[model samples]
Each structure stands twice: as C-alpha cells, then as structure tokens.
Target: MQSFRERLQAFNKCVCDGARLMVGQGDYGTYVAHIAKTHPDQAPMTEREFFRNRENARFGVGNSSGFRCC
Candidate 1:
C-alpha cells in the first residue's frame, strides 16, 4: 500500500502532466517508448519535430489555425 504522501505526490504529478498535455506539451519519454515498441526499425522524430508535428496536428497550418481575436 502506498503512503498518503506517496499517493499525493502521484496525484500531483498526474495533474501536472494532464495540464501540460492540455497546453500541448509533448511527452518525449512516452513517444520514445512507443516508437521502441511499435517501430523498432524506424527512426523516431527529433524532439523539435515531435513538438512541431504535435502543434501542427492540434492547431493546423495557415492564419486561420488556432484561436483568433478580431
């Protein structure tokens, strides 16, 4: 059984990670793990490309992409 402090720490980490994801912060460790398991023969994208690709997928290309205020 985990102690209260340990559980609290875990919960805090989960919340922080969730917030980061919500704001488009990519998880490189998980990405690497996935690539290692599913595409061992292929090279993974560099960290910069990973984040850029994520942003492109989330928002998209051009001036119309993302939030706009008039």
Candidate 2:
C-alpha cells in the first residue's frame, strides 16, 4: 500500500495539473473558485500565494483513508 506522503504527492500532482489546464483553457477564475468551495485547503491560488503557502506547508487535503457518508 502507498504511504500517506505518496498519496498526498499523487493528489497534489493531479490537482496541480488540473489547475494548470483550467488556467490555460481560460477558466482560471472558475476553477479556483470551484476548488475553493469543494476543497478549501487545496483551493487554487495566485502563483505568489501558492508559493507562500507551499513554503509554509500550511494546508490539509483531508484524511482519505477513512470512509464517510455518501
């Protein structure tokens, strides 16, 4: 089984790629707002804000190992 770090890395990569595509497709604002609402901690941010938050490592993507309501 993959470790938490591995899972987090995969998730982050996917999100990053998705965000980039959205921005390139001219849906930056929409994508950012949608992610902010759906996944607040992983919400899209400006490049500056992204670097600042990333440097601080201050965000959570929720605990995915456990089951939740459907």
Candidate 3:
C-alpha cells in the first residue's frame, strides 16, 4: 500500500498536469517521456528547443504558408 505522503504527491502531480492541460500548455515531462519511448536512438531536444519548436509549429512561424494561428 502506498503511504499517505506518496499518495498525496501523486495526486498533486496529476492535478498539476491537469491544470497545465486546461491552460493549453504542453508538459515538458510528457514530451521527454514520449521521445524516450518512441525514439530511443535519438536524443530528446532540450527544454528550450522543445518550447521554441512547439511555438513555431503552433503559430506557423518561419513557414512559407504565411498563416498564423493567433
């Protein structure tokens, strides 16, 4: 059985993740885990690179299509 402290920590983590999702923020931890699981041979991007890439992808930055989502 899990101790109270352990259970509380886990619940807190879930709440935090849910909050981030509700705010449309990507979780860096989830990205890292996905890369590790699906692309074991490739290194995951640094957090800064990940966020920059996500932002560019979201807003169509540096794309010739010339469309911005926001």
Candidate 4:
C-alpha cells in the first residue's frame, strides 16, 4: 500500500494535470479541495486553508474511526 504522502502526491499530480488540461498550469487548490471532500479518506479544507496547512497537515484517509484530521 502507498503511504499517505505517496497518495497525496498522486492526488496532487492528478489535480495539476486536470487543471492544466482545463485552465493551463496555474492554481487548482479549489478543485483539489472539492475532490478531497468526496473521498472518504481525503481531508476537506478550503482552497486557501488547504495550502496553508498541507505541509504539516495530517489526514485520516486510512483510519476513519477513532481518528481525526490534524
């Protein structure tokens, strides 16, 4: 199984690719946040806050119960 960082990296890459396809390489934080909300494992945050917290952020992707995003 891929680590959280690996999964996040993949997710970011996909977001970037999609953004590039649609709007040309720029910002896709809004889209990323939207996708994150739909997935059980992904953490949801506003586009502005997502970038601000991503570096030290912890998500509860693999563990739903007895876990919190911090």
Best by TM-score: 1
Residue pairs in collision within model 4? none
lDDT of 3 by residue, 1-70 (tens): 9999999999999999898666545789899999999999999999999888777777788899876875
Error of 3 at 61 (Å): 5.1
- Provide the lDDT at 8 for model 3: 100
Off by over 4 Å in 2: 25-70
Clashing pairs in 1: none
Which stretches of candidate 4 lie above 4 Å from their native place?
A: 24-70
Q: Higher lDDT: candidate 1 or 3?
A: 3
The TM-score that candidate 1 achieves is 0.65
Candidate 2 lDDT tens digits, 9-70 = 99997788777555432334565778889998884777566555443432322435443322
Better of 2 and 3 by TM-score: 3
Find the number of clashing residue pairs for candidate 1. Answer: 0
lDDT of 1 by residue, 1-70 (tens): 9999999999998898888698777687789899999999999999999988777666654556554332
TM-score of each model, paired residue for residue: 0.65, 0.34, 0.65, 0.33
- lDDT winner among the candidates? 3
